[model samples]
Target: MLVFGPVRVIHCVAMITRVDTYLHSVPLSGAVAEQVGPFTLFRSTITWPYYARPVPGSEATITADDIELVRARCAELEIPLSFEWVVETCPSLGAAAAAAGLSVVEHPLLVLERDDFRPATADARLEILPTEDDVIRQARAAVNLAFGEGGTAVGTAGPAERDANAPAVADGLVATLRDRMLQGVSVAAGAFIDDGIVASGNHQPVDSTTEIVGVGTLPSMRRRGLGAAVTSTLVEHAFDHGVDLVLLSAESPAVAAVYERIGFHQIGHAGAAE
Candidate 1:
């Protein structure tokens, strides 16, 4: 068993700042980060565009007009206008986005300190996959199918669905993942059985902090603890590689509870509007 030290309020606030800064840096790496009013609009140089986020430490209240300006820029670029932010830190942006006719959703944001991780148990074997591994495509397909089904509950989807979709995984996406892994910016992990990858996830590291994203288990594989095990593998990998803080935003409280069982705790909420 692992024991977690009490986090001071001051320390927590400072960690939140680091998380915000790290989040801002990710989009800037692959997109053209432009300042539109009080928000930073991340215009994609590729097929998919990114969202606008409030500039860190900016006190200017986000207005409908500010949202419109970003909307206009997104329109010119032929991309959907969207926004994401830490709700506690950027409290006003959600309402402004909602008032601008975007649907807003709040997700539970959780964090795990190095000392807080507890290894989770599952029947499937968990491993950190190399960029060149052929199973990478299968893992991505499993993730896509898992997220498409959309929930923590077990359903009909399984290995058959995963295999059928594996070949359709975009070559560009696989290439991007490989390039990012080679650059030491991202790491991918999976929980596997003989059939193939049952659960998959990735972590993007920036300095001493990393955020786990896109973790999902095939619907038929749910309730077997694969999601938690995969998350633990990623978190352990991050800590072993010098990351001190691991963060992830869960789709809901129920989803957050899976991470909580492995020692993550809610620190805040992440807001998204589209």
Candidate 2:
């Protein structure tokens, strides 16, 4: 068994492989198609153009030609292509993207094992809610506001110019979240204040590992440890239900420190190009 940081590694191949596969498999409104070679292309209304690397068990070398192919596709769609990969496993991919004139940023990868996770002492009105529930609207709104109000997470492209509450964009996001929840690929947790969601998160289970994402507290409600509480709530629920591992990509050093208090340790680094 391979060991990384303080926990026995759960997804040994690469964190990017696992996360990309999960996103590709999930039901989304946009285009999800496999390209030539070991690559997957995703174009969605709610996110930047995603170019995923080869799935595990495939030995495909990504070359400049592959990058150009992806670039061409993104160009046709009029969207910026954000190619992400585990820096430890695919340095060549990062190099290729750099040579192609895309800006690449490397960030830390964090992991928490069930046995190793240190659960927080108290829960702050955390509830696991389905995406189809009435409360989901508020949760979705909270996520959009969090990302829009805060700086974009590391390894992720920034949101588009339009505000999240714009009618058409909001509708697309709501529909996408509903589909994800109804399909059982994702579960959401929220911290409520007087029946309204103030902080929210989503966890997507991929095989034995679950990826915790979208954990955010309302801007007005920050500084009370709500973000930490919400993240721990998601991880604890997954582990209690038998998830072997949970992983997340920390957007910055300060964000990484927040998770470290919840018992996640840095395992590796991931690079994103836009």
- Most accurate candidate by TM-score: 1
Tens digits of lDDT, candidate 1, 1-274: 5544666767777877878888998876568988988999898765356899999877678888999999998889788889999887889888898899999999998999977888897998899988874678898899999999998999888999999999999888888777778888779999989958999999998888899999999999899999999999999999999999999999999999999999999878899999
How do the predictions measure up, each by TM-score?
Answer: 0.94, 0.78
lDDT of each: 0.88, 0.69
Ten consecutive residues with minimal summed lDDT in candidate 1?
1-10
Query: How does candidate 1 score on lDDT?
Result: 0.88
Going through the candidates in the order shown, the clash numbers are 0, 0
Instruction: Rate residue 39 of model 2 by lDDT.
Output: 67
Q: Write the per-residue lDDT of candidate 2 for residues 224-264, one digit (tens) a residue.
A: 66677888888988887778778888878778888899888
